[model samples]
Target: MATTVRRTSITLPAAHLGEENPLPALRTPADPHQVHERDRAGLPADMARQIGYAPLRSLLPVRRLDGYDRHRTPTDLDAIVIENDRLRATVLPGLGGRVYSLVHKSTGRELLYRNPVLQPADFGLAGAWFSGGIEWNIGATGHTTLCCAPVHAARVPAPDGGEMLRLWEWERLRDLPFQVDLWLPEDAEFLLVGVRIRNPHHRPAPVYWWSNTAVTESPDTRVIVPAEEAWHFGYQRSLRRVPVPRWQGADRTYPVRGERPADYFYEVPDSARKWIAALDGEGHGLVQTSTDQLRGRKLFLWGNGPASQRWQRWLTEPGTDGYIEIQAGLARTQLEHLRMEPVSELSWLEAYGPLSTDPDAAHGTDWTAARDAVARGLEAALPRSYVEEAYRAWLASADTEPREILAAGSGWGALEVLHGRFKLPGTPFDEATLGEEQRPWVELLHNGRLPTGSLDVPPGPTLVAAHWRELLETAQADALVEYHLGVAQWHAGDRAQAVRSWERSLKAAESCWVVRCLAVADAESGHPKRAAERYLRAFALAVESGQGDTVLGALAREAVPALLAAGRAEDAETMLGALAPGVRRRGRFRLLAAQVLLALGDVSGARGVFDAGFEVDDLAEGEETLSETWFAVAERLVAGSGPVTETVRSRARAQHPVPDAYAFQPE
Candidate 1:
């Protein structure tokens, strides 16, 4: 379907942007233009001050890995400081509407040019990033880097009250030596990243450092991750792939064409295990980095943008205008992993590597490169992958059945939704498999006490559907048990019986919430539109009843889609907009808004909403999904209308359905 491309860059009217968010300043500039400049372009800088650094470029101190140097020298540092060279930097307005800047740091002999005007607010001060503010990091040892300048400058205490560096510098110091310098050629073809952390403060610093990398956001850019198994839906990584002895329900494990719109993070094997890596199609490259050594570490992946906007971008297009980023882990997840595996506390850990562009590059054009790189790099960057290798034998003792799934739905039907068909691997996960505490909830579902929200609430759908012949009599209500059996029958492709059971369950329901659960059940059962309406109702009821944030979040997820399916964008926008400011703290809201805005083809606006919302959630690869979606939307808009160029469309088309999942078929 073609779309009309509006040449007019979507802008938030003055009113849409309320008060500025209180983002901590990174460094204080002498001229203060650094702080004043921001996401938007169009400001008059004093001409004399604009070129003020030209004469004294040589005075700027050059930062090196081991120590500070006076001049840019040949070293294995991420960034080097150039002292006393004429630095020419200008922010010029571009035809595309963003402000392009040509920055010449003569001391480093680097010409860093960027369209700085198009800054996404959520691209925060972390990792080796571009397209954000200009910032650099140099540690007591290891790499130094000269990155894109930041829109805002921050303040840091001077060593001798001379001057302050950027905010990121302090953050770098606080999280000192997170990475180690790898084999960098004199010309520095690639800046090998290393990360390390030590508890410097008297109190243990709660930190989670997620490895972050951004790729050209486009539909053709597929991601390939190596794992024994992946989730049927949602972002959780499975330790072992769910084995599908038989396809059950609507869930399938392997995707047919490519990866779905997902934010899944895996728990990789330790160094002792054969290393695995994630690769992109076309065999461009693959990198493998893991915290196999780090205990308690949880991985994160997400896709979103800006705050809570009405537009939504689905990540199923083919294109190159957008970007995808991978963040290792945040302080919340990383520190816990470190705490659990104290013996693995080495500053640097090999997370993963991207495949090299050269055909003769070490790992060749195989997935093994990713794993091999991790094995080699982790000993220095991340020592944990190596240390954890010893415990592999122990974990094997406590094993459970794996889940296998495949993707069989259309893009629109699947979209941002995650489907996890919980089929037990070895043991049948029937009512018996459910824990005692969970049994009551199961009974509630069976008894029609739980609201279907948007899914058909079945008591023993899996049990009755897949292995009904193995059913045994239990000490449960006869009607409830029978209703469950019916629901299970429905799940196992017995729709007629499922419907009858649902009707019976509704008649037996004690409360209206039970009916709501039925609605949820329906939605989960593929009736998204109906599920949406029920969710809205449930949301309203929850609001009236003063339901907690969790409940509200669930309702919002349901209601938004219902509104979308009902063609209630304006209403959804209003409701979501109203709920956004208050519930902006909720990750789901941010993601939902991003989804909507992407649908509206408002990529920039969607990004703004995701950015604002991400400050609270730090959605991680969630950003990648959103970025890819925008690229897709951009392509669609360009093709249908004409606001975006053909070049943009072509690029985007090459990047659709990013390879984010891996499926291995038997030989």
Candidate 2:
């Protein structure tokens, strides 16, 4: 059969992606994998500039997605499939346009690591990301906030006169629009993905894009890339160059040899083909090769340490085999953001398929031999010239309008386009897609003011880009107007103006949103005590009005932590006590309760939490809070009423090993 596209479903035990947390992400998720100041001591000028360019200070406009709990049901998720005669690719249109499965029809072999469940962890920039097949990471440094959100998907004409699946969305972080088109030609074994990132604005924008592919990993699996050295980044917060395949006295080619989670950004020479592959012991697995525009290749793996082992189980079912990540991006490292010029875009074509190479050469200790063997094999299957030709061919049909709409994304893109009068072709953000989130903003656009609403419920989603900021600034000052303007100003780096706007909004009406934002500003300004007080006030107001909604309960999660940080432990406990029974039972709040108990010197109460066994459903990839709290509880227990000093803490860590469930993150 020729290539075709159709809508389908994939059944899995999926944690319901609960409502977006009402709390604004005033701080980005802390990443120890990022480069440190010391890491820049010896870099070239261009590399240094790119690495340090446009790091995100906070995730404004976007809210944290921590409302999900440890609950899963057998659900039939919305999916789209692209099929050819030889291969079948399953995509999740409702959830980030992820390619969930790619199957080789003849061998019935799953080319990618098809995740058994749709379990979301706190991995993306805006939170709630899952581990699986192939995910396109766009926007800023971390995984895109759009990971759990929907994207506009449609059926478009392919380069080969066939239909292809196209996914597009407006990336809010850097205010750019991007599209990914998946195409399969007649009788072709390879899947071709054409990606385009556009800087529609007149000014330059920092861009980040990575096509991350997860493949089944084993001890004998060898990764082949065309590079002699790589820019290695570890959780140690350092980025330094090291020899490929044999770094730190281990054959880094094998995922099992890695001692800790790290990223190896291969320093591929300018003349080489851009590709990466992970072949099994017998030399058959997945290969990902992209055009020269997507020049960077990388390998990321969860190392074989105790922490890695625990994390492996946490991401999926326990005892399931782990997976390795081989990615292609526009920059040398995930830490760097490429600068896309005004009105210009970076486009590339990527191919994915099954590859079988000489097992002896691929698995050999000689890195050159192994990489060369795969490189030659890839050339035989699909050449660099052919990839370039395919990219040009796809570019020819890039402006072809969608034949049919498969799925709908957020209306933010439509809102932006309508406001800015942007003329983008091929990808249309139809006015029909606008929903409740954009209603007030839409009013502000046409009516010269936002519609006022009740102060009790959470305000509509905040729009913080420059264009939205201009509208909010001139709109008639009201509680909602000022509050949203403050968010926009904060996002624009005008802290003084943001604070003034918030203060003015509060003078008009009492709103939990404005107060919480003020509290965050206070905390960031080093007024911790005032921040804590404001946080409590915000939470109390939300509770009194929202009646313990899951969204409102999220503010409590922030308030208690703030109280404890301000050395008001007793206040933290009291705040926790006020929570409804159902709210307290949430895994996140249960964990917080333990911390509160510990702060109140109730060691036994804290210990009871662990004894009962609790799992934080959205525990992050590198987060070690579970183990930290466990040890703190252990230290208190070991001290026997004495003050738990450093020596006592050492004894606790030495004697009371954390149980498997909570044990993640290397010491």
Best by TM-score: 2
- Each prediction's total of clashing residue pairs, residues at least 3 apart in sequence or on different chains, is 125, 0
lDDT of 1 by residue, 566-590 (tens): 6666656665765636575455466
Per-residue CA lDDT of candidate 2, range 549-652, in tens? 66557778788888999998888888777878877787788899999999888999999998998778777767777888999899989998898899999899
What does the lDDT come to for candidate 1?
Answer: 0.33
Q: Model 2: what TM-score?
A: 0.98
For the record, the alpha-carbon RMSD of candidate 2 to the native fold, in angstroms, is: 1.3
Instruction: Candidate 2: list runs displaced more than 4 Å.
Output: none
